[model samples]
Target: MLIAMAGLPGTGKTAIAEAIGARLLRPVVSVDPIESAILRAGIDADQPTGLAAYLVAETLAEIVLGAGHGAIVDAVNAVDPAREQWVSLAARSGQTLKFIEVICSDVAVHRNRLEARQRNLPRLSEPTWHAVEQSLDEYAAWSGPSGAVERLTLDSVEPLDVLVERAVEFLGRPTSS
Candidate 1:
């Protein structure tokens, strides 16, 4: 399974993706840390590091899927191009692709979470609330359901346990015998 998680900053995308990865015992590949690594490796932060990081993560996920392991990708895949990459990858890898979009329906709560978040990685700069609003404005609408990929929408208002359980069900994981 290739679980591609998408959402704007502060929408609990990372939290949900991490929880799902843990529950399924799958490796989680995130773009932010990859971008941070690029910067720390003497690359200028002004470069197109975000795209580079996404490609790096794509390669990593491809490797994981090729190795016969499920992989979860965590990112703000707000654009069609980025989303399309994962769809293509799953096709090439012969893995079932699940696109999960996490959202915080409550605007006030989302803003609070954005403002209160502390960056654990020093090299990765955090996005401001205003930036998140801009991203929300530019986020592309989904291209509708297709046979090639499964879509799941999640509202972060639910408890983490509930969210994780719902994700497991959405992914069609079989329970232990």
Candidate 2:
């Protein structure tokens, strides 16, 4: 399964993705760290490093899937284009793609989490609460049940272990032969 983790910043997307990756023993391809490296490599922040990072992650994921291992993508798939890219990748790779959209439904909690968070990506500036608020306006609705695979929506307010368990259920835990 190729799990696409989607949500705005501070929405617990990465945390869940990392946990899922650890539980499933799959590679988690995260966009922020990739974009950070691009910036550190002197790519101007003015450039579309975010998009470039997504492309890079897609390629890395293709390799992971090709290696016969599941891959998890950690990204803020806020818009149709970004989300479509993952759909296309899954189709081309013939992998069953799933989306785990994490949301912090409480405005106050979301804002507080955003303000206190520090990802420590040196070349990548953390998003401001204002930016996340803007994203709330722009984050497009999920396209569907993912067309090829089901999409699971989780509220970040739940405990991390609970969220991971739900995600694992959605992914269908492996059974020993």
Taking all chains together, each candidate's TM-score versus the true structure is 0.93, 0.93
Q: Rate the local accuracy (lDDT) of all candidates.
A: 0.89, 0.88
lDDT by residue (88-177, candidate 1, tens digit) is 898899988888899999999999998999857657889999889988789988874322467789999889899999999989854222
Per-prediction backbone clash count = 0, 0
lDDT, candidate 2, 60-146, per-residue tens: 999999888899999998888888888888888988788888999988888898889888887999999988887789988765534
TM-score of 2: 0.93
Measured with C-alpha atoms, the lDDT of residue 88 in candidate 1 is 89
lDDT of 1 at 57: 100
Error of 2 at 128 (Å): 0.7
Residue 77 miss distance in model 2 (angstroms): 0.4
